[model samples]
Target: EGMDVVSFASSAGPNNQQVITEQQLSTLFSNVEEILEANQKFLLSLRQLGFEWTNNPQHLGEAIKKHIPPLKKSYMTYATNFYHAQVFLLSLLEETKPGPLMSYITRWEKEVIKIDMSPLLSYLILP
Candidate 1:
């Protein structure tokens, strides 16, 4: 009986942790103005060509054919950071208690269901 109680208590810790972390994430995501602003900035940066726009595709291709390096280094850096943030958020969710986490999920699901987000969903799943 003592061993059973200890195991139950240990299991309860992870559930509590997951709930707290999920609440934290939900609160963080709740500010729509800031989220929209950051998203707009990210899209604007992607659309900007900088110096690369001036290059002729055929000529640039031929010139760098033998010694080409990867492009979009900055974009890749940002993508890596974004992926890390998602993973961190998920980890926090897993660490939070189940009850509060469930409540957050319920709220978030309602908000998400109300949004018309085909474009945003595509971007979220992009490589």
Candidate 2:
């Protein structure tokens, strides 16, 4: 459990680039569930972090760094695991074909198809 958890997160993201992690680490430190649940420790951790997203949370990284230091080590492991779990859940739903979450995911897919990506083409498109 004490296995340099952030390193794992650093290794598992897109391009194995730890896209979930950053130099300042504002996002991952903000959620205990994101740190623990992703590491397969869901039952041992709190289900929520008791914080809410506001338009501006004010020095949020400072607050998170102060408060969440105890749980910040393993965010990537948690995120990777959580992503796998969601994929598994979605596939399970797909095989059975139809449920509340499945319906929501389907709706999201429909909405995504309507997005206009042309604006980002210059910066995001690969040569």
Candidate 3:
């Protein structure tokens, strides 16, 4: 519960400054981790299917049996939720950058957080 993932933890700002609430930051990662787990499971199921690009009925049928509807649902779920989270985090980073709170954020944080914005990239690398 004392993890240092909070963006404000490393800041050089005044100890009394209030930039982002702990609940806001925690909730963002909580939602992200939740969607990440759900989407990883779905993506892994596709990877595990191991069907080639053949036109055979059996192979195609196996793919179809894997349920495309739910896959699409999961994809959309991840896409929309992640988009909102990314927008919020990006705005937060920018809003804090010119202020004393910016000192609390490291350059690594700015660079690495950009990677968190893409959900599709996760599908490609998760397996």
Candidate 4:
């Protein structure tokens, strides 16, 4: 809690010196993690079904029944909470060109978060 706002916004110009709070960052990661964890469980359920699910159409419903609702909820939560993170990221991107924060965000984009939710949302939203 002994954070220095000056150091946090050191690279930013006077007009672009809005520092991202720790809570905002935590919200971003927590939302993303919830989606990832929910998807992982859904994938695991599908994998567990394996050949039997492919062979029997009925098994597909049972395999996904428990996983889908929670996955959908997690995605909805992520979608709702992502705006703050997007603003934070954009601010950082604007301030930290050719710097460590830019590289860190780039690495995080490629490796930590490779999520594309359009297709998943279509499936989740369609009854």
Q: Which candidate wins on TM-score?
A: 4
By TM-score, rank the candidates, best first.
Answer: 4, 3, 2, 1
For each of the candidates, the C-alpha root-mean-square deviation to the true structure, in angstroms, is: 14.2, 15.9, 7.9, 10.2
Clashing pairs in 3: 11-104, 12-104
Q: Candidate 2 at residue 34, lDDT?
A: 51
lDDT of each: 0.42, 0.40, 0.50, 0.56
Error of 3 at 92 (Å): 1.9
Residue-level lDDT tens digits of model 2 in 1-127? 3223334433454444333335223333234435444434432232233353254355454455544554445544445444444444445345665643345445544555567433211211111
Best-to-worst ranking by lDDT: 4, 3, 1, 2
Give per-residue CA lDDT, model 1, range 42-64, as digits (tens).
54544553456467455444434
Worst 10 residues of 2 by lDDT: 118-127
Per-model TM-score, in order, reads: 0.28, 0.31, 0.39, 0.57
Candidate 2 wrongly placed segments (more than 4 Å): 1-77, 116-127
* C-alpha positional error of residue 119 in candidate 1 after TM-score superposition, expressed in Å: 13
Local accuracy of candidate 4 as per-residue lDDT tens digits, 15-125: 574434457545434355566677778888888888896689788898678888998897777667666556655666567344554554455445434475242113222
lDDT of 4 at 120: 19
Two-way TM-score contest, 1 vs 4, winner:
4
The per-candidate count of clashes, in order, stands at: 10, 2, 2, 0
